[model samples]
Target: MEKGLLYPVTNAYREDQKLDGLWDFKFDPASEGEQNGWAKGLADPIEMPVPASFNDFFTDKDAREYTGDFWYLKKVFIPQHFAGKKVELRFGAATHRAVVYVNGQKIRSHEGGFLPFTADVTAAVNLGEENIIAVKINNELHRDALPAGDTVTLKNGKRMVKPFFDFYNYSGLNRSVHLLAIPQGNIYDYSTSYEVSDDQATVHYQVAADSDADIKVSLADEDGVVVAAATGQKGELVVKNPTLWQVRDAYLYTIRIQLVKNDKVLDEYADKIGLRTIEIKGHQILVNHKPIYLKGFGRHEDSIYAGRAFDLNVERRDVNLLKWIGANSFRSSHYPYDEQVYKLADREGILITDEVPAVGFKMAAASFLGGLDQSFFDGDWIDELYKKHIDQVKDMIKRDKNHPSVLAWSLCNEPDTSTESAVPYFTKLFNDSADLDPQKRPRTFTLNEDDTFETSKCLKFPDFYLLNRYPGWYHKWGYEISDGEAGLRAELDEWQNSDIDKPIVFSEYGADTEPGLHKLPSIMWSEEYQIELLEMFNRVFDDYDFIRGEQPWNLADFQTVEGNMRVNGNKKGIFTRDRQPKAAAFYLRKRWNSLPLDY
Candidate 1:
């Protein structure tokens, strides 16, 4: 079975409940919840909003940064009429680890912090009766965990969430929770990949069912006209003179899969699918066989109080901002975003570089602090991390494979690829992902400035290249303006000479600038300096044919761990945390609007 089988039914033709809004919440700091039987019911639980982070609610900073077990309890009343149907409790996402219990009985558990998980509550649920849906959530990090970190106790005897990467570890229910009363044996999974040639489309599709049932699949255009229809478990449907999905010119067709028997529609499932193709050819990325340029930012599914939760109000604003800035593509950065983000991208013709939450990944935490050695090789730890890392890759690929917006799959972000021992890990991961994806999207990983093609043997694994370099910010900070440009140019020239025929995108590149800070001479933390650095980088980007895309470090300022270098968070965003555009946004808007989307 595919890893996506773990995901909820996307195209359920039956009735379901959206378990949004407020729920009874509590923090189990002492870890005595099981002994106290908190799962049964909390004695004095405070009301907290669902689909948002619990960190931002408290007045104390310590409460906001708590990393241990927290509970979200809700009482749901299932309708008596839906008793015969199979009901499920689906969570959009829970932080690092989650345990679900229904009516005091443990139902299921999931480990991923950003992926959806479901539990069957048909037997546990009391129809027409109020039932307790209790969830015990934890965000403590282990070395073996994906995006590994550690829980450290300080000299004062206080534990802290010490992350290996940047960004605040906001924990809670970050996405929607659903109560799906779907049919017992309905269409669970289906996907479509297409071959489009301007005027024609040949769509290959597959459907998975719980049991044997006659299936009728149809392709409907925007006009609600069925272009092609078929009957089978898997087959091809052809449409003459079909419209192709394009960046900023997206077109889509509805795929309706119906379960039929004896002239009766047993159950039907439907979703909008875009007909597009992606390919790679000699240092260029092709969309629908046409070489295209990617113009966008590396955005996170993050915000003020919601943290990583999915909010349509914020989502719509973000989409409008991207469109207003003349951007046609974006990377999910270190993690996969909510499913609705992809849906919006598909409709607006926005391209995507779907990524996994494999950030903070390294050989081991001890290796970095012990001797600061770059070449520490451990057989046992490598195997353990690889096992955990590859599982996330499969889950990410399977859940996001069908989206037209996703142009490629990013295995990780800025991992320790400079080490020689890391070569086998990347190679193995890339190979494992190839087998899981049906779309066969080009796979790549983001490389930091330290990971050079010459030094890192792991560089050979990816289909393309993505480097995160901070020229003016990190390498040539003290150099004069002209000298810094030359320094950046030198690095690019060396990369151009490397002779690797693959598309290279600067997945991250920017200097942290305080929003209103400005100086005539241009200095660090100054707005002028930020604009100047970006303009210089853009010039260098234009000069290289192999550099197909340039996504600045972030779309907006986001919360991160408290440190001297960080003013609340990473200020590398073109916009502030509230989505207000800074000097960089305007600069990119003008440049992106003027550039040709195709090479």
Candidate 2:
């Protein structure tokens, strides 16, 4: 069954009770939670809030950098009215891995940290009585996992995570949890695809539910008027004078679906959709048949207190900042973000390039460590990682396929595409995703520095190319700025002359700048240097017509693994961690606000 992890909404047919706020928490360093019966209750546990990371809550080093099993226990009452309904516990996300338990009985387990999962507790919960919900979560990173990393055992026998990527390892529930009371045989999943004509649009929809009932679908305008209606499990709704969803100017239509038996409603679900089409024509990206130039930043969910946690207040602030800076789109870099981010983007008319957590692949991580003697695809680990990678891609698409703001699917970021082995691997991913998504949006992956136009073998799989180039910052530093510009131009000339006919997007390019650091002539790590670097990149970008989008490295400074290369964290953001503007922020704001949407 193609059941989607739909956002639990409280409506006439459903009840959603929040299981957020404080929960009893404790660390199980020895992994003895199951043996010692900690699932029944956590002994001497401390209060930890749901939807927040536990890393920065304490001042001690061990607590902040812990790597082991941690448990959270919450007691909730199951109302007697829900006795005949299907009771389930839905988690927005659990970092890395999680296993849920109800009344000391294991319910369900899930891997991959960025997507939602559920546990059917209808048979386990005591009706009209208090029930214990225990969740055991682990935050270990290994080469076989997504966002690959290694665990180092210190001499003291404690474990520490040595991540292949640059980001810090922050773990927790990270998002809200809820207790849902739904009808026993309800709408499990639904999908919508659009076909726009000159004046009319046809929306094709498919629904999966209990086979005993009949399905009815309707399309409505914002004014509470039904535009089209159909009766069946699968059908099409035709509407006249459709308003297509646009970048920064959105118009959404509501799709209400009902499951009926004998002319009476058994269950119903309502969701908003924007009727838009995204495609690539020649060297341009088109949304609703018009070309668009994407202007935004690659942002992280990290914040002052909420390290990678899903906070609506923080999300709203980030969106408002994007509007102020005249950005119409952003990429959820490295991994998928909370579902609320996509819903907000849909309402605000902001575009998104959704990505899975298939980062830090074999070749890139090996290069980062030192050098690899063999091909990246020659290991047993690669086979396991590939299986895990495909699962994440499937789950990510299933959850995010319906969103109009998601214009593309980024399969993986910076894999080892230089080798011939990567061709078949990425080919399978691109081909499979084409069948999985109903919208059939453009698919691509971000390219690293080593995957040059001449060396990359998997470039043909994607509809467009996304490059992460750091010319002045990582290549030519300090006084050698002119050389960096010359090198960048040389590479651009190669791409322009290459046989590839796809559009190019500068997915990442930025310099790390201290907030108040300044130099007269613009040295590295200074605010002036960042502005100079951006200007140089923009000049190079304008020289080529195939260059369609420019999204800088980050929107705000974020936490990273401790090293001499990072100053407390990565300082490549145009704003501080608290979302305060840097000198580069104003520079980009002026540039982006003046540029046309189709530029």
Candidate 3:
């Protein structure tokens, strides 16, 4: 099996087609699809949208939360012109796990679902003839899977996926699908980064190919003039007066790579790169040798009907909201988002802390570290889960390493890093992640609040600190607002006196506020209480210079597992589910807008 490309380039520069719209779907509850030969295609199937989750479309609650196998069928005719070229079927993403078959012939089986995967179906399908494409996707989160969980069948025959994380398990073909053609022995993979000195920028690049071929690399300025060119498998190109990619002032250069043999161009690829460098220096995060503060939110890939599917309209609106709130950065909380978001971030100069979807290590939903019994390190499936965790991190870095907006890489979210057993697992995971990326970007994890700064076995591995704290909401109860503020200040003071020299980011802060709820004196779950909590936290940020960044718990309300503490889903967003602003949103906008661009 061939390895998938690091950055999946489309034939959009050439010949490609979007395999989106509607397709036939069926649920294989008995897991008898293979024995019954459903690969040839289901005889009669229900109509399902190509890229959307099948949960909300169904009326039966049992079907909405079904934990078994579901099949999707689509038919296509490969044009005769694609006969000589290498034809491939690419799925943007299929939840948890998937198997693809073309014309009743098995093509590929992929483990992780959040990243794109492709199968070289050049020999599996006949050109100029209609071919049946069938995919069986499963969202069952056993211990060996990336997002680990288990399901239980009730007496009513309803399958319920237990909550290990704080997000909904909306599953299906949750991203786009495409069919593209590329020349054989083309530019298989490449990586590029820049180093700025004085007024000049040097681009160091490497290209990998199937066979020995002449590699041509060019850097075109924003004005469409080729500034520099190189010929080799790996080399450097220097450009003068490079326009550095800055916050809210994005400037990019186009890179054109070509494969040439005997002066004949066999294949070509084009991408954009930002000429800038980022590093962490002395409790300060610097970009292009200047310190810049991070103000954003921990965001999720969620929508009303699409679930985790990528929607361009939603993407535009979300970015607009971020701009309105004066935010320039966000952590890809819990998981890496769709690739389109990364592209938009690059274009808009939005900084990102890219994260992998290894989210369920805590096993406890509400209280932090309450599920030591369900901790990832002590599980019987530790070896298998650790391997899967490593692969997920590698896949995330390889796919997202080229993007300029990605400032850091998060290994996991809210995991128990406080145990002795977690030491070797986290140390090896962070080391392997660094080995995978050529640039070796900053690495960190979302430190659970239960883990103290001094005792956390893995905190020393992160380049900086990303903490999830809820002072006013969670702890120091049975007290007035002043007491809550005092408790929070004491905690910060302890962290400051601990003499840890790393820059810290308050990754998760803010209270759950229903859109219209209000209280005169301020109370939990009300708009006034949410604002009060944030204002109190804001005071601490002003006091501590090491607090380099602040990203609230969430940007908008999103769906999660059903529970009594949650109303429909988590309501901790400054904006409502439909994109309306809450009272806290107004206060947050005012505060963020006051910060200077360089802050």
Candidate 4:
């Protein structure tokens, strides 16, 4: 089995069958699955969907709040088409972590669940007959994991999750699962880089294969006309007067690659690519050497019923809503979203800062101020956490390096950087991640409220600054509007004088508002207050020329861990959870529509 992440595609040499449907599931609150031989089959299993979170589908609170080992079993059949072919089970994602067992034998174990993984189950399956596949999933968060959190045990001997992050801990098979069949000596992986001249663009490509063979590549435009062709594992293809992939106006080219020997094609792979360039020149983020002012929201892969599952319908609706609001870009806040989401972004011409799942290293959840503990960096678990973090980073870059819509790599979101240890930690990480991508896109990490201009030790690490501030909402709530504005100005003044010339993007800033709740004199949790707070932030943003972008805290309301701070879920979304417009939606639409793409 080749150990590379190549997106599964259907062609003459490959076929993908989605293994998404109802499956036998059982919750292991006592963690007795392995000991009881449950990996072979769950004795008394309940029916659940494969590509969905089991939390919201259940009626009881225990099932919805489950925080331990769970098992899913599904029966699959391998088609009889002779022999000597490669077959694998590819999971788009399994929440937190998962271990696979086929026909009562352990196949593979994967960690860090937001990315894709494949297990070569060719030998374990019975060709032309039914085979059993069992997966054991664990959702207990540890300090040594990405998006760090703790697993607490109660006096009743039940386990629960206390995530350092604010969002709900939705777990299970949250993305599509597919059974893939491919020929031997298939194309394993590929990457592309670009160089633009006055009227031409040259694309540099490198392909990896399981066996050494003659590599042939061709680039085709929208009209199905081949613009460029090359023969080699690594070569360049030049197109005259190339149509650049612009923000909100995307143009894509199809790249087809093949492995050939003695005039016979052994394997073929095709993917869509957009040629563009992104860089930070002084205080502006330039796309194709032109400035871009991002007007969007920090989005989550969340919705009702599906939870975090990759729902194409919801994804389409969200992108349409963003376009309706005149948004040009968005950050995949906190974690890497579904791969299909990025593909949609490429087609729709939406810019994205593709982030990894490295969120919430803070010591607390409710307030960033109270998280003063440096044990997250100083503890013995730091190395393990960093290793897992770098592993996820490598996976993220490998999976998404070629997408033109991805403008930058957001390394972390709101990580604790108050201590001196953050200096070396982030320095090494930033350098390592920069080397992984062929384009060498700009790298950034969102700064929390605690990591101010003077307090942040890793301020100089990123190519640009992505700050998540809640001046009016978190710092100065209620009638202290003037004080919040003054505090915001004070912070901006300090940043301006700090000699940091990097472009600044307000990655997250918003207030939670109840739908239809209003008051004559605006108060917290009221729709009027949410609008008032955002307008205040916009005024301050316009005063500073260094501010390059504004993506409010959220695109829509989403579920969060149950607490007194949250009612049902986080209500900070400009749109309601069901994709209906809130008052803030219209306000943002008016403001964003007036701002040009280059503003």
lDDT of 1 by residue, 1-599 (tens): 12334334444357767888999999898888867888889879999888998888788977888878989999988899776778888888799888999989988888888877678889998999899999999988766676667788779766687676778888899888998887888777777778889788999998888858799999999999999999998999999999888889998898888888888887788778888899999988999999999888998878987787888888899999999998899999888888889889999999999888888765332322332333423344567767767877777776777789999988888777766677777767877777776778899888877677655668678888888887788667734656777866777788788777898888888888899997888888888888888888888888989989888988898888787668988899899989999998999999999989984
Worst 10 residues of 3 by lDDT: 363-372
Error of 4 at 457 (Å): 0.5
Better of 2 and 3 by TM-score: 2
TM-score per model over all chains: 0.96, 0.98, 0.96, 0.98
Candidate 4 — which residues are off by over 4 angstroms? 366-375
Q: Give stretches of model 3 more than 4 Å off.
A: 6-14, 366-374, 477-481
Quote model 3's TM-score.
Answer: 0.96
Report the error of model 3 at residue 389, Å.
Answer: 1.2
Q: Point out the higher-scoring one by lDDT: 2 or 3.
A: 2
lDDT of 2: 0.88
Q: lDDT: which is higher, 1 or 4?
A: 4
Clash-forming residue pairs, model 2: none
Encode model 4's per-residue lDDT on 1-599: one tens digit a residue.
12678888888889889999998999988889988999778998999997898899988987898899999999888789725779899988898999999988999999987899999988888898888999999998988997788889989877888888888788999999989899877898999999876699999999989878899999999888999999999999999999988899999999999999999999999999998888899999999889999999898888898798889999999999999999999999878888899899999999999999998776744242234445456767888888899999999988888888899999998877888877778888987777889998999899988889978888888899999998788778889987989998999999888777989999999999999998999889999999999999999999998899999989999999877778998999999999999899999999999998888
Tens digit of lDDT per residue, candidate 2, span 1-599?
11567778888889999899999999999999999999999999999999889998979989999998999999998899997889999988898999999999999898888888888999999988999999999999988888887788899888888777788888999999999999999887888888886699889998888657889999999997999999998899999999888899988899999988899988988999999888899899998888999999888888977798898988999999999999999999989999999999998889888989988775555443553555565546877887878888888888898888898989888888888888878877776678878888888999988788877888788899889888888788777878989988898899888787788999999999999999998889999999999999999999999998999989999998887678899999999999999999999999999999999
Query: How many clashing residue pairs, candidate 2?
Result: 0
For model 3, residues 1-599, the per-residue Cα lDDT tens digits are: 22545445664334668889898999998889867989898978998997888887888887888988989999998899886778888887899889999988888898887888888899998888898999999888776677767667889776767657878888888878888788887776788877997689999998887656699999998889999999998999899878888877888898889888899887788888888888999789988888889999998888898787878888899999999988999998778888889899999999999989888776554232134365567778788888878887877877788888999998888777777888888878876676777776789888877766765777788899898887776675324666877866777788789867888999997787887887788778889888888888898899998889999989999988877667888888888877778888789889899987556
In model 4, the worst 10-residue window by lDDT is: 364-373
C-alpha local distance difference test of each model: 0.82, 0.88, 0.82, 0.89
